[model samples]
Target: MLNTNETRIKYFFILGFPGILPEYYGPVSALLFLFYLAITMGNIFVLVFVKCERSLQKQTYYIFCHLALTDLLFGTVTLPKAISKYWFNDSIISFYSCLVQMFFVHLIGAAHSFILMVMALDRCIAICIPLRYNSLFSNKTVSVLCGISWLVPTMFMVAIMYEILRVPFCNSNIIVQCYCDHMSISNLGCDHVREVKIVALVLAMISLLLPLGFIILSFFVIIAVVLRISSIRGCIKTLSTCTPQLIITCLYYLPRCFYYLANFVGYSFSVPVQIVIVMLYSHIPAAVNPLIYCMQTKDIKEKLKKKLFSWKIDSTTKPMQDKTWQ
Candidate 1:
């Protein structure tokens, strides 16, 4: 416990998966290390491909690149510290460092939510208002949309962080989850935090529900528009574009909604179970998004195949070149 006048603490101990036995730390750390590596590499591939490939320079792929950026930042912000906690026993994070982590975690997440809504809006326009999509969502317009996606969430998150900082945290300096977040950290403050909690809940709903509602409505419009098309092939082609977005959306939101509901229901879930649920919603989406959105595309798959074949040929010829030199 901190002294009464000591409103702030310097470090907060992050306890990741309290249920893990001492002997299991090695395996868990190794697994998380691999997980982080795969997610970062995959998102990087998507980001580079989008930027380098001429064919993928449209607004749609631009949104994909931003999504990749968000996923990469999110994974970097949340996972590395948790891995260190288990692997290197570096669980103590500075107070400001934890706050920075919390900011980016929520910022990237809210940005992704807004981006998904923008993607859905793009799809709706492409399908429902096909004639105007190119006009309505020009490069400048897309840039503005992307700017809004990043900015609005940041403003909200900054406000949340400010409120959290204003409250003195004289209580335990231990965070119950894998990362520092508004809810987890704010809950630890020794002050009367009922109003803080309520405000946090409202901010959460605004950050999540507003964009979510727009996404749902946009998809409904998209499906309705797609259903009206007379050509079966056209309908199939249009629906194919939406499949990845739908999958990514479900992967991102469903588990999150369930986790929130579980908490609200006051179910006595173990700490490990709660952390596992959080990991499922947050980590899995970032890890799998590149595969779903990029690799699943026929163009990207063909490009990858050609690259692999060329690499194999180079490797095969390298040995011959060495023999000749000998």
Candidate 2:
């Protein structure tokens, strides 16, 4: 039984790796880089393809474009630094660097969460009141939603930053995990993380569970509507459109749901499992989104064709064809 007087283990001792297995720094670092290369290149290609392709400039997919951008930002904020620490086993981030890292991480994370919410809302409005979907999710409305999705997360991250800055450092300054995570930074604080945690819980409810609840409700409604459609073709088309979004949402949220559940429920998963879980939380959102949007979208494909064709040159070393932006 932990004593009431025992301060909740102020300042976690980040004793170096437990070293259960051999450290393959070389292979791990290489693998991490390869993953980044794939994610970064793929996402960049998707975004540029979408933007350059004029046919893609529509409401729902426009929402998806911004979603892709935010996901890119999310991956950018966490993985590079994490990859740095993982291969190096070096935990010497300056306090200021840690603070910035912490801020951007939460910023991107909150943005990703909220953007998913926006997507659900867009789908909901489109399905629930198709008559007014154009009016409801108009250029202005979507623009506002996208702007808020980026801005609110910035504010939320600032709050977490304040909480983290209040901590009193103890013995060791090393972070045990791949990067400077939320809990790891929170652990740096001394007593009185109570208020911060409550705020955290509330923000999380807004960010994750609240949106998830809305999405679930909206999906059920969407499903009910599809069932009532007189034509099977209508039903199938609706299902097809929803499928990619559903898959991407589940992939992005399920791991995070499990990671938190594991933390709250008390489990004995090994460090490697935990590490993989964390990596999934950071990477999969970025990775799967482009794959989902691009494969499902024909307009984007055409734009890619146009852009690639104009940008490619003849083998005879002639100049490239002129490109026209739609």
Candidate 3:
């Protein structure tokens, strides 16, 4: 219903936390900044520790490294802008920049889902068919799987972005979300809005549901395999290895599934509540994944302990050496 003379919007305003009071912005931004720091440092440590330690170079660790990289990229893409928006009251983003952010958000998110599916598959094969685990998931195979994770999502999102580009934006330029994404940006378009929404919803459902389904199925198989073990100690030991992945998988997928399902059913929450849910699912998993891995994975835990002990030793000895020199 918009006239052709209505000026095309050049930039968009992100109205993050729609009902939040001005006084609370600093505290919220500080919390977000802390999450950004945790995500950055933890994932970086995982990547570096895995890379430098030759003993950690294996199929499972390779998948973990890929996950760390994906999580780091996810936090980098989404968090800083939200942080700046709150800290500086800078919510304006140029149209193209928003599109670029949307593209990367979907791309990386899809890649992450696929990567998780790969992780589930990896665990499934390791547990179900231990004899051929290495042969099944070789270095080349992992590289191909990870490459496909990134590549397929890139191609899919590029197509979506192309469709998004064709839509004209001449109406409201305010996005009621912390960041730009397919839904938030597409909703601003004045033409083909419903069609775009339908297409986006369908694609999102496919992208999210497919991997989620696979993960669920994989876990079921893993549980069955674990239950079949005759000895209680062996079963407990096997289940412990899977516990971290299960925790992270639930953290990453469950909230997102709920949000998407709610959207599909046309049930809506308050704007602030919706944004909070999105942030909880998107940010918390990345921030917590490294901690879960470090605390649960025996190899990483031992290495971290050793590294910290060495640092502690150096810290105490350095002051003693300085006093002796004096």
Candidate 4:
């Protein structure tokens, strides 16, 4: 028998419910849509700019593009659906779509963490092993690393998707956190959730904790290496090269750790708190990445600026060139 008050079941799928009430949901919905659009466009620009610039063919820039792509997929998988729910005031997610949503959210979430870990390792290599770093993390090597990073999450996501399909959603349909979360869906399960929770907890710890520890350790080694270097100019150049990457790593990891902390403590926060966390690490990271590279790398900014102003100068000189030719 069906249990949820807001939705009806037609055998396998439970119709989704209307979104939040109009008294407050309207403005909040507007804000979410605008932010998602901004994040997508901003990250696309970063990826495009990086790919087009020949000077950015180094390992660091290659990893930066991968991070930007992860951020874009991360933002896209959930934000658009959240906007739809708010616009129609309907929160009813179908059984299959909800499963797909959770799969992608976790997939991109895992990829984002792995790519950051790779970036940290890249920084370590460039700083600690300058000469061999190029051959070590060349285009082919980086591509293979990125491929494995993406595929690891995909394998787990496929397993989870298979498990989710077997369970029946006879109890609830509304997901509270603006997007589908695994634990929230597990809470509505028709069977014992112990195995699910245990698997999820283990995966979460691995995905979150392992990379975090590596980053801290890498930085510790990085700092020591920098201190031992005799030349100040060489040290400054190395440190400057890594500043943008470190800023992005902090932006992604810091708030994600907080969100996991909240989940661990069994604390109940309002919906807005969840949204804030997504903004702090998840959505905001996508936009900040492009800006970070722009500000940190003067050559990139000069290239962008030249592209921007070239149109105007070309427009002004077109007629003059024609007259000179005559």
Against the hidden reference, what TM-scores do the models get?
0.91, 0.83, 0.92, 0.87
Identify the leading candidate in terms of lDDT. 3
Kindly list the per-residue Cα lDDT of model 3 for residues 152-195, writing each as its tens digit: 88888877887888888877888889999988888778887788
Across residues 190-215, which tens digit of lDDT does each residue of candidate 2 receive?
55567777777777668778778878
Off by over 4 Å in 2: 1-23, 86-90, 302-326
Clashing pairs in 1: none
Instruction: Give the lDDT of residue 172 in candidate 1.
Output: 81
> How well does model 1 score by local distance difference test?
0.85
lDDT of 4: 0.75
Q: For candidate 4, list the clashing residue pairs, or say none.
A: 16-92, 17-91, 17-92, 18-89, 18-90, 18-91, 19-89, 19-90
What shift in Å separates residue 25 of candidate 1 from its native position after superposition? 1.3
Using alpha carbons, what is the TM-score of model 4? 0.87
Please report, as a residue range, the 10-residue window in candidate 4 with the lowest summed lDDT. Answer: 8-17
Order the candidates by lDDT, highest first — what do you get?
Answer: 3, 1, 4, 2
Error of 2 at 3 (Å): 23
- RMSD in angstroms, all models? 2.5, 5.7, 2.5, 3.5
Q: lDDT at 20 for candidate 2?
A: 32
